[model samples]
Target: MEHSDYDVVVVGAGLVGAGVAAALAGTALSIAIVERAPPPPESPAWDTRIYAISPASVRFLESVGVWQALDPARIQPVRRMDVSGDAGSRVVFSAYDAGVAALAHIVESGAIQRALWRRVGAQENAVLVCPARCASLERDGKRWRLGLEDGRSLSAGLVVGADGRDSWVRGHAGIGATLEPYGDSGVVANFATERGHDGTAFQWFRADGILAYLPLPGNNVSVVWSTPEAHARELTALDPDAFAARVAAAGNERLGRLTPLTPAAAFPLAVMEVEHLAVNGLALVGDAAHAVHPLAGQGVNLGFGDARVLAALVREREIFRAPGDPAVMRRYERARREDILAMRLVTHGLQRLFSLPGRLPAAVRNLGLNFTDEVGVLKNLLIRQALG
Candidate 1:
């Protein structure tokens, strides 16, 4: 068996994992990224899998040299957002009112993934270990030894798990997680609107589900409908025209008539909480660390924030401290605790609040939305926090 060594080993090459490795570009640390599958090939057509990238996340990507590489023509800036409640209550947020360039940028997942993959693959200190699988993990003195199915092994002082919700590295490292399914699945697809979205994003909290129409470049928009499992099945089963009509009607045809631009897809929705973010020589980032409701569209941003902070801490650590030093892990955990807990509580609370089976509950929630909308300072505060 061939044996290799590295200062840090990142498991999973998803957006967060690749972001972490790319962020360490000029560092002295030798990093290894273990990915089981290769990145998907780019398509000329718009992708259905879209992300609302927060402003703060953009800065992190820029620092890692991934943002500049993206095609500007393909990106859409969200200048305004409109959220409505089932009882006709609404709240609006604008970048101008918040005094920012934009609230967030709508981007395709593949573009960022491919860009990060290329960036890290070209880095002198970063090694891309694709088409690889982890077979075993064990403590080898002060370092962690990761065994591959191909009879090759690598040793690293720090093992960062960016794998995902069901993180292999985290499980092997004895980290436990709590998962609560929302009894819903997010149905996603792209559409061409008769009228352009004008760089605005729209979301509605309905009796059946939560729906969001995110603007895309040109006259296109991406939609994510977090509906009950049964409804999700029906949505995906609908023909292109039927599906587009259903989606358009749900949003009150805010963007006018719609035509499907891509096939609809669905993914189960869940909220996950990990017992610990790090233990000894192992630390976790991205979905490996936590999972939250998608209503706020902040899950990816939170993951990117984890990568940015973790990389910065590793880079600025004391000379004598290893990448996985207890102190470094402690700081990472402490710094992220509040943000993770806050988001979890907010998303979970909202999901539950609207799930209540009473007209009174609906009225109260809708009234709350209207009240919040009337408060300028409160709305601006929310925009500022979300801008991060």
Candidate 2:
């Protein structure tokens, strides 16, 4: 088999993987990105799948040169967030209150991926091995040997898995994962709202589930309704007009009449945690390492954090330590443990708390929201944590 070698091999070219490659562009280590598919084609219609990029993630992307490459016209800054519980309780957060220009930036997932892909393509030390797949992975003494589906082979001191929740690399590396299905699906779609969102994001914890209206450029908004499987199926089955009507009603007509800009899609909701983040010469990043509920819109942000920390650790490793040294990889895992655990606990706890079946529970949770909102110091701390 034809063979190649690199200091690190990344088995995924999604946003997080690409970001990792871009972030390591200036490092002395050579890197290769193995992807099964090419970058997504551009479309005139806005993508329904979007992510709220946290401030820390924004700085990471900026350092990697992906942020500046994105189209500014398509990005929307979240100046404020308005969250309402099933009851009458509501909590509001403003960027100004947090002493930041914007709480977060809402951008289409495709845009970010494309921008990062472009960066990786131009990166001197990064190689894009797209339209390829890892057929098998094997341990070669102190290194990793990967066999590609295209009959090519590569060796690396370290292998990074950024292949997402159903990671192929993680499975091959003998990593086990525990998955908790929420019995729900996240229904997402784009809409042209009758009223302007005024650069504000709105969320509602309703009896059905949690719904969010993320503001977009102009009068557009992206909706993610996390509902039970049956309800999500019902929503996806509706015609465009009917779906629009149902969504508008769910938000209490907050955005007025809604006109679908794209077809609605739904994906299962689940929290997945891996047994171990790294073992020997392998490490996991992004959804491959961990996943959380989308109520907080922190999933992608967490993935970006993974890339940021892993790249930094790799860059600062001791000269004698290989990129895949167990001790070096452990540091990256340890640094991320608390942040990941805290987010999982918060998102999972909120999901369970709201799913309880009783008026008392609803009242208590709503009251908690109100109380948290009233505490300026506490809210700022929460905001700062989310910013990372």
Candidate 3:
């Protein structure tokens, strides 16, 4: 078996994983990225899977050179956001009011992934190990070794687990995670709105669930309807026209009639929290470290936060300290705990509050929304945090 040595080994070449490798391009550390599949082929049709990229995340992508590679025509900037409570209460946020250019950018998942792949592939100090699977991971004195399925061995000072929710590295390292399934599925699709979105995003917290209309470039938008599993099944099973009409009515036809731009798809929802972000010779980023309810549209943003923080820490570490030094791991955990905990608690609490069937609960929640809306300082504070 061929053997290799590196300063960092990153597992899973998804957006966050690739971001980590790409972000460390000019660093002295030699990096290796392992993935089971090659980068996805480019597609002209819009991808149904999309994410709201926070301003802070945009800067991270830019630093890694992935942002510049993205096609400007495909990106959509969000100027305003309108959120409504089921009990007829509402809150509005504007980028102009916050003194920012835009709240966030609505981007397709594939575009970012492809861009990151291109950057990492060209990075001088990084090696892209595609179509590779991890067979075993074990400690070798001061370093960690990864055994690949294709009879190759990789030894590194640091192992980064950017794998998805069910992370093999996290499991092998004996890190525990608590998962709370919401018993709901997020149904997503794209549509051509009868009216333009005007760079505004809309969200409704309803008895059925939370529905969000995220604007795309031109007269198009993407919708994420988080509802019960049964309802999600029904939504995906609907004919294109029927699904579009139902979605239009749910959002009060605010964007007018809708025409299907893509077929609908759905995925189960859950909240995950890990016991530790780092151990002696290993660290977890993105979904591997934590996952939150998507209502706030911050899951991927949090993952990007993980990638950025981890990369910066590694790049700036003292010469005497290794990438997986105990002190470095502690710093990474300490830096991220507060942000991750706050987002998890907030999203989970909101989901439970809206899921309660009692009228009193609904009244109180909506009242709180309205009150927060009226408080300019409070609303701006929330927006500022979200902008990150």
Alpha-carbon error at 341 in model 3, in Å?
A: 0.4
lDDT of 3 by residue, 187-293 (tens): 99999999999999999999999999999999999999999999999999999999999999999999999999999999899999899999987999999999888
Instruction: Estimate the TM-score for candidate 1.
Output: 0.98
The window of 10 residues in a row where model 2 has the poorest summed lDDT is 313-322
Which ranges in model 2 have alpha carbons more than 4 Å from their true place?
318-321
Give the count of colliding residue pairs in each prediction. 0, 0, 0
Q: Per-residue lDDT tens digits of candidate 2, residues 226-333?
A: 999999999999999999999999898998999999999999999999998888989999999998999999999998999998888888872654889887788988
- What residue runs in model 1 are displaced by over 4 Å at the alpha carbon? none
List the RMSD of every prediction in angstroms: 1.0, 1.0, 1.1
The whole-model lDDT of each prediction reads: 0.92, 0.92, 0.92
lDDT per residue (tens digit) for residues 1-388 in model 1: 8989999999999999999899888888999999999888999999878999999999999998999999999999999999999999999999999888999999999999999999998999999998999999999888999999999999999999999989999999999999999999999999999998999999999988899999999999999999899999999999999999999999999999999989999999999999999899889999999999999899999999999989888988636548888888999999998989988898888888877767999999899889889999888877876887
